[model samples]
Target: MNDADNRPVADHPFPRFSDQELARRRRAVHDLMEEAGVGHLLVYGSDRSGSAVPWLSEWPVTREAALVITPNGDDHLLIQHYNHLPNARRVARGVEVDWAGPSTMSRVAQLLPAAADQGIGVIGPLRARDHQLLSESVGELVYLDAQYTRLRLVKSDEEIERLREAARFSDLSVAAIIDQLEPGMTERELAAIVEGSYLAEGATNHIHYFATTPMASPDTCVPAQFQSTRRIEVGDILFCEISAAYWGYAGQILRTFIIGADPTPLFVELHDVADDAYDAILSVIRPGVHARDLVNASAVIEERGFTTYDDLVHGYGGGYLPPVLGSSSRPNLPVPDLHLEQGMALVVQPNVITPDQRAGVQTGQLVVVTGSGADSLHNIDRGLGRIG
Candidate 1:
């Protein structure tokens, strides 16, 4: 049971939440716990490199990581034993924290003994660890994979604003890459420009960068760090996808460009077909649409004249997914039938290829389904990009 007041606000760049906003979200989480009959909820954040915990708390949790929230409305954040200046500051503010080993079980017990003894419903990422800890510490404990994922799915007005800002930064990055389109520049150079632009636009510290040379043989997704050193040549085609994060929110984008000459007639035809298919998926997208149906529509694009990189349509937004959920990192292609509903954001991409041609068409959009239809967060050029 801790209260994190007087938390320093100067060290971080993220805008501190207005007292109103914090109250609103806090109330929302409490309400959700009440509805689910959860006496306490524990949220475990990624401890891996580039964790989003810092972005949320304005402080890093070191090796130890887990957030405990009691139904009485107390927030306790437990972390590993470093006890650096940042950790000390947070702990001093009554953030019921303890230093423990990285073992998940050790971390779980430190955060939930009281709740477990009281027979409170506990939900989070540490059931196994909780059980182990309980066997040694006190009473039996039960936990479900309870998470705030579904609650966080719908964005609040303030959250929506931050996401839009992040998307705008990504859009700016894309435009910068397009501006640098030329035959002589290396893919690495272009990637640098994109990342530099993102930073200049106040993007958060984490970044995922990738680029592709559509005209090259055995075209493959080149990671940003290892973008082909080979210089771009005349008539080279470029495709890039970047996932950007700001204030702990993330959005993905894809854009293509052609250098030295107009895309070949064949390329133009394929691009149009791909665009149409992307729109086709968009057309069927609305509240209550079945995710599998959207996947089926994407398949039609492949059947007509395109190649799908993979069959995938998962929601994306502020929170990164857990391992079990099929996400970009651990893709379980062709996910089971999931219903599409309002407040769910998705990326619909359909890459179409011709039966006789080696080249393929690719197009996609990030959209949010509304009651009436869908709306795009960023508007892409109808004609992707032509450098000629």
Candidate 2:
């Protein structure tokens, strides 16, 4: 485990968690099971979305996969799609891998203990049909999705290192777009540039959203959740929210760019307010800081008569974990009564948009909470981006 930790990440054809790190995760999950009085834990995933499958077995769930954890440390991992078996076996650590066959839930039900004292604790996004199957097979089915999310809030040392690598890849993606953006290029081309930067480096796209509009007569504020075919034009503002992942760990960054011209006065003001709000929020991001404190710091944006379209701050590096907060001007979710911890990572974006929702700017990156303050994992320049 020590040797693997010390070796360069590029040396491994596929990234892996060290044995020690895997053991720690198993122990933590076992503790959770004990607390919940569940004899077994079934971590399920489909279409590669659930964070728990990869968090436990290091096999990022592809078509479908489920990790059944028992107290005896003899865990069984079932993978769907016969072709995905080889890779799952190669990458999954500390588990017995098998084919999940025609019915994934049936395979899971068969593997679970016939009788558990507190029933079966399940995590991940289970389809209603599968949920019913599991419930029928086992008398009680306890949903522990929220509890599993809480378990991922504070990262471990190895996890933090992986997050730093993810952040570097995210920075590279954003920088590639900034350097190659041209007036004639389409947003689809921009998306290609972002992925082209890091795909070869074994990083996958978590998300790359773009919003391009004429700065003179703006039409959009926040970056669209999906890319568009609209071509970039001179005097257009292009803002993006991008995250590139190394394995399942990912880094998020938001940046706004002006194509083929300098920013106008209004754009400058909007970006300045976003930058100030980013700084203000970061200033109070030490361990033990309440979630509301970060929101309060962002009051600068509203004071400057601007609003935000996206979340002001959100936990990152492990499934958008907790303390998802929005500015006072626009509260996305109830301000979570959560406090920052030393190893917690967050993206402090202040997507300051105009009150009329016609214009906005993106400016922020992923940062980890330290004992004294927050430390940015990304090295990209934090100034307003300009391109030709």
Highest TM-score: which candidate? 2
lDDT tens readout by residue for model 1, 153-180: 5566666666666777777777776676
What is the C-alpha local distance difference test score of each model? 0.57, 0.88
Model 2 segments more than 4 A misplaced: 1-11
Query: Top model by lDDT, which number?
Result: 2
> Any idea what lDDT model 1 has?
0.57
Error of 2 at 217 (Å): 0.5
Q: What does candidate 1 score on TM?
A: 0.77
In candidate 2, the residue pairs with backbone N, CA or C atoms under 3 Å apart (3 or more residues apart, or in different chains) clash, namely: none
Question: TM-score for every candidate vs. truth?
Answer: 0.77, 0.96
